[model samples]
Target: MLKKSELKDLVLEYGKKFLFPDFTNKLTWFVAGVGGAIILTPTPLKLIIYNWLVDSANLNSGTRFTLAELAPDAADYSVGVVLIIGALLHNIANRYLVYKEKKASSHDVSGQTNQIDKELFKKFLEDFPSNSDSIDMLRQQDFSNSFNIFRLANLEKFVEEWDTVEREFLNTDLERMRRELWEACYTFNYKLSMGAYDLNGGPIFSCIPDAYRGTDNWPAHVDEKIDELNGLSTTCFKLYEEFVRFGRKSIA
Candidate 1:
């Protein structure tokens, strides 16, 4: 009964963890070898690079480009194209599995949180150990508490903990935007739970299954919080996408 957006976020973030962290490191040498030849001998190697680049017989048409189309000299053009593509692939790979601050990371920066949430959420749904007692617990409205805090704490110290990350390496603006929306949702959930006896993150207007919300006791201005909470969730996802896209472009 999970909403469409929840499913998309879970699947994408889950899939990201599987990406190889060393993808960029491995690809660098290939680009450097070809790129060095082009930079040092731009004109002479044009024909050779042009032949290798447009060798469609060996590779499929996955964003294929030619030296002529890329630059004045085919060699230089191919080098630019290769470097551009290699950079993008590396960016995705890095974000998907980059876990540098292992000792320093507290909560938000943990590389595997997204993947852990996915597994925990799925297991919660598919409970198997108990016969009746656990099944009854799953039916409770506050079942979300059985899982981890998928959202982050709003304190500045949480973000500061990640100071080990270079400013250039992390998208500070995009991460900040996401953090703002995440804090908005987290705060809203906290206030909502106080008025109605529910678990911390339970009864989120936008994310809760329609069946679950109908049973829970909501506040007078329920629509207002729903509107705000749903808006915050949407903004958070948009900011996350921006983080990934901007990282691809910014990685040198």
Candidate 2:
């Protein structure tokens, strides 16, 4: 639950968002306010215009002001009412359009995720005929070895798979995973090419690898990288489990 102040702030924020979706909306309301007041209020300018019209009509001898004389009044705010309603309708329309666009974008991302999930399942099945065996293979693998994780899981292939999905279909999570995995793979290759570490070490950062041989605070840096890779590994495993679940449900 929110406190009174927090609730008030939230309400004000949303109200402002609704009323002023953009600068153009602010300008629209400004014009509406000034124009409506001018047209609706019995101001000097309006009276002058009205009197001029009446005088022009009386100048024609054949035409006489025969009706009961009445003063122009806008106390009822008729024009202001119309302007307010128009502004409200415009704001509603803008919000509705934004809502529709976001909904459609969400749907597109969902469809893409489903498609990728099915593809991953198919790939896993191809690698291991038995679903249980496929899962066992994933479970038994070492995640601490970032290189092994990259190679065994064929992270590059999945990264490419994302490329096939339209850019617009890629959501934040998907893009993030792809970028992190790609970086892991790229960093491994870069280190190997630079001869920073020998191939005999198996590219595991269990200790101060050759890459950080002379560097100060290497342990902390290595630990940080290890944790980062560990996170990616965990995310990959969770995704695989989700794929299995999705596949089972689809088959059922």
Candidate 3:
């Protein structure tokens, strides 16, 4: 299990990693500044301009009166239209920029996450023998303690892999992945504990339930989980890609 400090650090780090790319975009400030100025200016200027155009074109009384009252009668309508268009464009552009940023950030985050996963995998592999020995010693002295260690080690491995998957994909389905892996680890451990052993006292293949002991079932289960992860990653990436494409198309 992770320490409180470690979990806190992970949350903070990932939160920042996800948020900073979005916070850096300056389009919002630019739009707000320009929009504020446009909306705050006097309405009389628009009335005067419309009045002049009305007279210059020799328009009828209806048109002339309409132009003269443009500020009072149409000011709200005109401003609403402008604001709507401006807001729509701004949101479209922001989405495109955010999508681009996430794509670039994922590459960097994935690299770091991969490195961490590999390191943890290596550490676990290295310590497996020692862990096995410790388990054996505890089993002789206290079975509960040995089970506790086994559980901890299993959970640690799961966490390491979970982190790796998150960093590698940066998908919104990270929570799902974490939950699935935790459940898988728990089930595996439970089954292992119930299994039988050989004369050498090592767990035997026959010890596991026949449902889990098929020649191909374990590999198939692993593949199925991996496929689920890949599908989630693809979905998030496609979401970003579609947002970028839609923004570009709207501009065109």
| Tens digit of per-residue lDDT, candidate 3, span 1-252 | 999999999998776544443323464445455556546655676567657877877655544433436545344445535764675575666578668879999988877755564554344335433245332332232211112333235334544454444433223243344345445444544543443233234332233234444445555554454344334323433432343344233322
* Colliding pairs, model 2: none
For candidate 3, list the clashing residue pairs, or say none.
Answer: none
- Which of candidates 2 and 3 reaches a greater lDDT? 2
Kindly list the per-residue Cα lDDT of model 1 for residues 1-252, writing each as its tens digit: 999999998988666544443444555546555555555665646665556868863478666555444444433455656775765676665655455534456455544544443443233223322233322222232432222222223212223332332312234554464355335435544543343332455432233334456456645465555555445435434543454454334432
lDDT of 2 at 32: 70
Tell me, by lDDT, which candidate is best. Answer: 2
Q: lDDT: which is higher, 1 or 3?
A: 3
Model 1's number of clashes is 0
- Clash count for candidate 2 is 0
The model with the greatest TM-score is: 2
Error of 3 at 27 (Å): 8.7
Q: Which candidate model has the greater TM-score, 1 or 2?
A: 2
lDDT of 3 at 178: 32
